[model samples]
Target chain A: MSTLENGTRRSPAIHAPGEREITFGEAIREAIAEEMARDQRIFLIGEDVAAAGSVFKVLVGLLDEFGPERVIDSPISEAGIAGIGVGAAITGMRPIVDIMFGDFTTLVMDQLINQAAKTHYMSGGKLTVPMVLRTTLGASRRSAAQHSQSLHALFSHIPGLKVAMPATPYDAKGLMKSAIRDDNPVVIFEDKMLYQEKGPVPEEEYTLPLGQADVKRSGEDITIVATSSMVYVALEAAEKLDSIGISAELIDPRTTNPLDTGALIQSAQKTSRALVLDEGYSQYGVTGEIASVIADGAFYYLDAPVKRIGAMNVPVPFSPAMEDLTIPNADFVVETAKSLCG
Target chain B: MSETNDTNPSITDLDAEHWLQAYEQMVMIRTFEETANDLYTSARMPGITHLYIGEEAIAVGICEALRQDDYITSTHRGHGHCLAKGAALDKMFAELLGKEAGYCRGKGGSMHIADQETGNLGANGIVGGSAGIATGAGMSIKLRGTDQVSVCFFGDGALGQGLLYESMNMAQLWKLPVIYVCENNQYGEYTHNSKAAAGSMVGRATGFGVHAQAIDGQDIRTVHATARLVIDRARKGGGPAFLVCNTYRFRGHHVGDIDRPYRTREEEAEWAKRDPLTLLEDWLLKSKQAEEHVLERIKQEVKTAVDDAVAFAEEASFPSESEVDQHVYA
Candidate 1:
């Protein structure tokens, strides 16, 4: 599906679909609430989903309107929330289960993979688990390990689940609606840091279909593809690269499972140099997939070994300084892009 | 035999129709597995499957307690669960054959079997995987204002997993409409229950504030009664319950490959003596619920069904080569 705004051309707009301004959290909340209202089959369940309305209040006011049943609250049981969502989805319900933080998702990998991911295929396409798992993955707020992580890479690695990492509110709202409507299992990842961040989005119902990649910025110097929270850092780096007379193409392969390798292959063919950035450890992450896509799809076009910039290989340290050292920042992306360009 | 009503009869509240239905479900599970086991050993099947040979009662007992549309999340040893929840036998066999007509085009094999229409959420390969799914199913029903309950059938080994605890906490905290059925058949693969599990099953569930029970899994009737009590309450918003069905695997961990020397022959014999199928048949005849000729006919019906299932699977074609990527995404 075409992005609501003009492709790669940002213009100030008042009532645009993807550019109409709204806070990221508000956009996400609206997506969830609107879907629940539109389809009687859709409902949400997660920790603090009710009166407390989610730890971040992203699900705020949901319980008041839908009551305990629809806007249900639950124990801090990430695995159960995910498992329940899978069950409900397979049983003719569309559930948006919430995992308060991304780190907790490890507790529910079985349900997400062996259950949600495989059900449709295993049942010979006789079953479809149409479910959404919504949670935050960001490290800037210093939540530390066990609370903070951008593990979109892990979910994207799974074959049956569709992984969505929206860099802005417009993408978040649209992508989430698409996730809700998708019959296969989908993982919708939101960077906690981006929740309060504002960007334009349409006020009415809309869906940004999954499996399509969005070329955020087009340039000729180098192509830099980043995911989730790293999209922000990549944009920042792109801005810095512009000052240095290097134009970098920034591509956010918003949906990772059905990855937009075609886009990466095309961009690599043009730029002839590439740097992939992500918030996960560099080893065996989404960046690896991007690298392979380029290597396999456009091998001869690269001017430099395709560079991958990502969070350092280590548990996210609790200290802010250590955390800063662990996660890839805009400066790190900028430096990597410059080196690759040289 | 003077058995108390509370002595764990599997189907306590239902009339003759429901009782017969439960019996039929159990037969479907037993017949499907036994015949499939024979075929599997002879190299007639393609993908390797974990047979639900000795545990028909647990699935039958628990599923009987659920409504037609109530959801169930099954474990890797899930053939019986799928059968009991109304998965067509022919389709299941086709899946085993990895045919185009198979459930997942033989891509998922036996570890993952699902039927959305009948509300059989899926059978998961990962231990304790169904807990979260069942909990989420409960949440969905609660959200829709319907009283449908969700059942999660996990092995006792699953109790040791962290996900089980996580699910228990959520289900209990919100009083979600879910039932956590721990089919404790004494072993987790080759490991003994004592070696693998840390705390009491009921104790773990109770700590999470869920009403919990320990029941006799060998007695299908007993399982039925206890499960009904918990399942009924969930449908009416009484919240979730945990039932640890203390059962035993009369066979080896998997199919006919009885290679594990973990449990002694004496233990096998002891459990064999409690075969649910035999007990139900005896009761059906002695209580005049069914006649001997009728029981024989029922066996024939199950056998014919299995025979047709094998025929259907054998005739089904393998999925076209391009199907590998067909169902990868929604």
Candidate 2:
């Protein structure tokens, strides 16, 4: 299927007209609601998750459907909330803890990094923390330093945790369902900028397996590995490069920890050039790691060194002009691809 | 110095069998810590260990009040809790020695021992780390409609952490079945609780509207009696309770913390006078519930069990290198 101008693909007309389109936020909500309905053990807990329905309105109807017991409203206690999720998961209940902002992950580091990530291993496979930590990433909403950050790299660095960054509505719904079913702790960082972005999602049941990369588009000239919100930018860049006779392939590796290194390397070998993109800081970030992996795996086949673009190593400024300069854009990707082709 | 009153359990409330059993567990714990200390001093044990020599009664008493399947989260100094909760002696010793036969298959050593079968949710190295885990267990119990109670065993040192308060707030608000048991050994590491904590321990729990009480931890009868009341209340939906057990540690913080000038010799001698094992033995004899020979026989039996456990741990094998990367995820 061909991609639209905005880089979102058009779903084949297999479903009813009214049931075809859904937003990224709706897809996430639908996934949780469906999972909670299927499994009585699944519960939601966070600040303003119930009644208030989240500040972004992602969980607007969950409280009404599940009630207060399944949909809990917790105080502004990030560490305690994450610890509760870990504990509940270890015992039996599958809890989806809503961390309102991704930047607030700093507050829950001890519980997430030390406790949740170590329980299964330290207990020697006796205890399993089957939990999901849902939070927002990306930095274009003018939310400023403390509220705006792409902290997926922080969780990805830890071994026990599985990190997922879904770039579309279909992937968002499918990946969330898979995360709930995973026996290990999974952190899903939803790009805050893509919450309302619309795409087609089937009304039928489906789940996307974690650690698998999806090819958004295939081309023979160059390979582009993008994550989360960067997938759209890469897609737009691919279209622009196609018009200029420079072909580009786009691959979205939904999960970072169990990265699809084989697919990434194979794509790099086929294209003979590769570029990695992420919304996190450039230094010691996801892009750097992926680029290193591609360079190592496709060293003999590569025509040029693998390049990476990430958010500038600085706190996201409040001003729109300064903020736009921090993250990767389609124009930058196009220019980078042109240089690599030359 | 004891907060126990006539309301607490006397020899009349509990029967002779329980008295003998409590005495047996206290003696076992004292012997275990002493043996563990000997292992460390002789350089036989691999890592450092925190002794639970003087704090036997509290663990035995509270655990006796819990059901076999009820949950309990422990602290750094946690050998007593594990044993009192019914962990096998051989496996516990194996865990300490990092043997494959250990409770955690040698993955967790002394500080991180976890026995799921015994409802022991692992001992934490971080101070006050298990507060939320314990509270979350209570939440799960409530959601699942179980009558089980969750006991969170921390130290007076944990009162310095904000997590305990946050957990206490939720446990109280949601009316979760959790008991926050603070083993107030009068010291938080090197500093005394008086210097470390700002307000009273009970006051902090009461600030969250949690049912709070203080009891003499050296007396197993009082600890058992108070724990029963609180655990029963929480199970019946009375919400969370905070218990400050006024106990003392007979040895230094860890096996290596010798020449400790944190407390004076006079203070240690004073607290040692109320050694929990001695207190129970004396009570057992005076009440005529147990004969002196019977108590002596119990101690001899405990000594055999401890010796056998040490031998088992010594004979056990270390985990293979192939298992190094296993169990990182389920």
Candidate 3:
């Protein structure tokens, strides 16, 4: 019911009272700054985290505040940076390593998965690597095949590492804080398209738990579980469904690794029709995992088979029109939801 | 071997106690590897192990120069480095046997042994995996403003890995206190270093602006002297340095490798003449730093220790099935 001076209907308010509005990018910067201020042991190491403030500018002004020692600028070596993160984390330091792109995770997979993820477990609990690998995900920015990728599913499939995907500015700040404090390694996948999107985030210190899910809209006809940038698309689809007299509930799973299957099952039980969506490929992705969870937990209560909407199984193209066709949008979600409801 | 008695200050400055201890450490490593080979041949051990037979001096000499608190990253052929860095023989044996009392509680076999209390970060299965970790540890030391230095032990096979150059560049650019020790043990798995490694080993380090030195890895005295100066310089914040220890692996790459078709027996015999343990024993006796009785006593001590470790490993229990899911997260 809240509206701005232009009389346009604002997005549904999700935060508690007295929260201030901020962009997803600003929320990330504030979280890093505040966490760095609180813990001297926490430091940032990556390619352009220092003087450049990162390619996305999500780490703007941190270099001057934390100095060169804490905010380190590494060479263009993902493996080296990730290795340093694991080493520093185990040796009494919390390191937040930034991989400039999610696609580049392939270059550092050995250090990230083989070394960082397995060190604590392989060491029989003698060592703990409290590190955060922050990278950007999602496409449609014309980044082509190399730069743009929503590879959260790959990380979530691994057992030893935690995966967090924050869809809103509020969740962005909160989840980042929790990730820094966690004793295990966490990979945070931020959608590049949502960096400029504005949402309410508290100015005071707060942290959201990594594995919890949030219900963006309470409805009864269908339950739509979405992640990262897809959360907003799902919300828009819900509005369109409301005009057609079909209620669609939206659930945002902040972290994919420790998935909130209980909340997802409860929502599916209420609606009896489930639609799982993601920006990643359809096969062996976040949508498939959610669909499996729903089938296992809410099969008897469901009125229809659980539906999934995902990006087409192909590399993201460079052209905007072609890329848009490959990626799922609000219209695609609405069409999928209507079919599931019928 | 004769050069050990030369008037070089680095070798001459070492006293009788240092020489005796260094000789004993090398003996322990050789005995341990021989026992490991026996265990594998007799089907007592389960997994594959890369024997560090001929490269004992590099581990013993470099570790002798380090303090108890300084850090060191190791590679797959890590048993010698583990022993030299003060890991207990029994626990390492227990680890090889995949017992609950092992360093990793039966999860990690020979390739992943680590003792944090002794400053030995876990050995990596990947060829050049530990370089970044050593560099990061150096960064941590610099940030903490500590005098501690970190050493990274790798093989000639890792020379072509980009992670090494990446880490070395960062270490030099930031003046991180790290010592990169490359044990150039001839063959990388199956290929010779000449075919696999391009240019020169020293050139790889010097190109990164790191002070590099190629030393005789078979000579424990030289290894000890060079490691002492380089480790001390790094601790003093003089920046990172690289040491290319030109060594040879007396055994195959792994337990099952026949080691034929690539290297000839004549080449193996040629390198065997420079066996580190023999060189050290010759130096100890010729220099009159240790008597025959003293040398025999050290051998007896090492054999007893290794025998006790085998017995302990035989008696230790395997982990329960219920605990398989533990330690995946902190």
Candidate 4:
């Protein structure tokens, strides 16, 4: 077993002949199952999590495997669930409290922001809330303003919360494991659109340390920093940019808090131009934060100003075309990258 | 105390040592609050504090029945709860004074003191905020297969909050070991609870199928008796219980606000006539639970201890500026 800098243990990767491939949902389920098996203190509580296997079916078979005691179905109370997660975490158990949707986080703001996030510091380091609030973030499911929101940036804005947006199955599994083991409160936002997406994952135990940016694709002309579902969009944009003789480097800073500003700055310095992208709203959102960081760090090396492409500053609409237009797409990334590189 | 399965255990049944200890705790809380109020008024303390001057019995009574390892989630006006739950006077005063020797190392101040060693989940600043946390503690206890009970102490003002009802519903549905203790001090800040809350307080808990009761908050013996029964039942997996302690607050909502147009002097005098400390003293004297000299001695000792706590807080250093960012994350 290898220990990460955050003091979490990771199992050695045992490379089989061909690595196993799984859906993003399955990878997340596997991560939770593995962590639960390793630690008896870990349990999951949420609405429809037990017998229902969750609304998204992401937690299917967990209740059967872990029993009803380990998997609990809670009432429709987000604030209470999050608060309970904080209380349980501080009192010796590691709880994974699932908020079914990212938009529902508004119902849990007081508990997450005031209670769970501040407990440790308020207690003068005498206590720690080792908990993870797993929720889905994405629009375009025909879900209206209340059901759809890429609110990960809101959580990232908070001081004590560690926000992780896993774009692939490999990162999802590894980051979920690390989040469960971290001493502080971590909020993991899984894109609902990426649940069925497939990616290669190691069969053996391995974990990814948060705050480490992953170089999804390497290039030289311009740097593109993206997050969560936007990483895939940026990847597509990078390919299109290549067709146009413009090479774009893609960096996903897996976790927003404790962000790898150095990696982003280094990449921007190398490329001399950067474009930050996110699915959250453009106004005071994650994209703006990343763009500013790069602008500040790579100001001298940049040939052009650091740009950002984010979801339009509007509540997610239910209409298909309206919803599609509101989100940041690969075409938009390519268009933004062209404007920056030109 | 004499063993009895009968409900509503009286002060007459309490043994000498336990009885004396209960009186000492009440005195300690009263002295602590008085000293804290003095500190705030004299500008010896950095932040504002909500004095627990009138409703000492509820804290002393409920906490008396709790084990050291049992959990408790307190409120903004939490000095009495901390004292009753076994927090050190010096650290509490230090926290109020923003000293490094404080319970939260000068970070939490009055509204956020927490002691893990004694199972305090921490005092919450938001009204009705700790409802979920206390219920979650019950969930943890149930999962861990422990007999410890988790208690949530909120004021009557919290009745307007929806989280409490949600927490109670879940607590009852899952049969979690929790006690929701509402010190209905008749007001939510400056507003009267009658104007803020609708319907019966106990009915809210009963609506969720939770075992519920309303008790006299000024009577320490009755509060202790009901708390003991409810806490024991919860520890044995009887599910959550809602306790509405009918009490009153003697001082203003906060130290800064001294004006009193919301309440009349007559109302204050009426509540003060049945003051928890005075009622307990009268009960002790009338029931011959102890001599007047012994009670006076307890009061004197508590005064000295509180005075020493004030001195300790004054002598303690403030946390360095570097500590501002420390512990933001574990």
Task: List candidate 4 segments past 4 Å from native.
Answer: A1-17, B1-12
Which segments of model 2 are wrong by more than 4 Å? A1-19, B1-12
Q: How close to the true structure is residue B290 of candidate 4, measured as C-alpha lDDT?
A: 87
Please report, as a residue range, the 10-residue window in candidate 3 chain B with the lowest summed lDDT: B1-10
Q: Give the candidate number with the greatest lDDT.
A: 2
Task: Compose the digit string of candidate 3's lDDT tens values, residues B42-83.
Answer: 999998898999999999999999998899999999999998
In candidate 1, what are the lDDT values of residues B190-272, reduced to their tens digit?
A: 77888887766678888978998888776778888887888889888999998888777766677755766887888788788
What's every prediction's RMSD, in angstroms? 4.6, 2.2, 2.5, 5.2
Please, what are the lDDT tens digits per residue for candidate 1 over residues A133-244?
8877878687777777778888887888998988877888889988888898888888887777667787666788787778877899899988876776777788889999
- Cα lDDT tens digits, model 3, A216-272, are 889999999989888878888888899999999898888998999999999999999
lDDT digits (tens) for residues A283-322 of candidate 2: 9999999999999999999999899999999999999989
DockQ versus reference, model 4:
0.81
Share of real interface contacts recovered by each model?
0.83, 0.64, 0.79, 0.86
Global lDDT of each candidate? 0.79, 0.90, 0.89, 0.89
TM-score of chain A of each: 0.93, 0.96, 0.96, 0.95
DockQ for every model comes to 0.61, 0.78, 0.82, 0.81
**In candidate 4, residue A247 scores what lDDT?**
94
In CAPRI terms, model 3 is classed as high
User: Model 2 over residues B142-161: C-alpha lDDT tens digits?
Assistant: 89999998899998999888
Task: List the lowest-lDDT window of 10 residues for candidate 2 chain A.
Answer: A8-17
